[model samples]
Target: MADAEGDRITLSALQDTQAIQGQTVILPTALGVAPVETTGDPRIEAGWFDNGLKRARKELGQADRSVGDERLPVLIVTRYLVDGTLHEDRAIYDLGFALDGQLLGGTRVRIRGLSLITRVPAASGQAKLDARWKQLHPKLAS
Candidate 1:
């Protein structure tokens, strides 16, 4: 949960401030469950990064009857433990929210542009392919 003062709460902050270090952040999928075991502090790129994927954006119609009209994206960039080695993974972003007991589009939490952890610029074709492969194929790429 975020603060009352409109201050966006980051996943890294949540993981750090609440002594949630060493916890494995898992993101479930239809294929299987993807767990991101943290190796160190998360590296945040910005307030949010929207890839224009509607699956991650919430519906802004008249059905919103829960929280106030506050919807934003937060991406979690961190070093994760992979095969006993530290690797910088993808930027996990969340923009989904539930309404009327139904799970809508993008999850309130989600992971996008993830790879096998790298020090490259993260803009290489191999990196994007790797990220997509992992997102689609799951454990095979990991």
Candidate 2:
């Protein structure tokens, strides 16, 4: 996604630091679920992207509940992986804690930073989609 200046945050820059962890990141619920909604539409072939977001949301929700507070920061990790053959795909991760209060209406969270945790090359677009699906839905991977 692009920042206020309309510049897309480079995936490389996002993974540069561990700052995003343990910090609260606020996201509109709309943007949070956009990937999932677009993927579910039969007319769109972005199911992989949608599935990944769903998985990430589930994992993050579990982690959030475990923390016992809703006010915690949310971590979001977005990436586009390109293999040696130049094939590319994108994925997003949710790694923050749960918040205690409402996140809407001018509320803002402080982002500590970002870090790269995984980098895998997929043999095809489908494979890349599967990788993201696996990330968001670990149960399916089993």
What TM-score would you give candidate 2 relative to the actual structure? 0.25
For each candidate, give its TM-score against the true structure: 0.26, 0.25
Clashing pairs in 1: 43-77, 55-106, 56-106, 96-107
Q: Which stretches of candidate 2 lie over 4 Å from their true place?
A: 1-94, 103-112, 122-142
Query: What is the Å distance of residue 23 in model 2 from its true position?
Result: 22
Task: Give a tens-digit lDDT track for model 2, residues 46-142.
Answer: 2223333334545544331223312211223222223322223222233322222235532122222233334433333234433544444344221
Give the distance in Å from residue 116's predicted Cα in candidate 1 to where it truly belongs.
18
Candidate 1 C-alpha lDDT tens digits along 87-137:
554343433322222265432323222223332344553444335434532
Clashes of 1: 4
For every model shown, the clashing-pair count is 4, 15
**Candidate number achieving the greatest lDDT relative to the actual structure:** 1
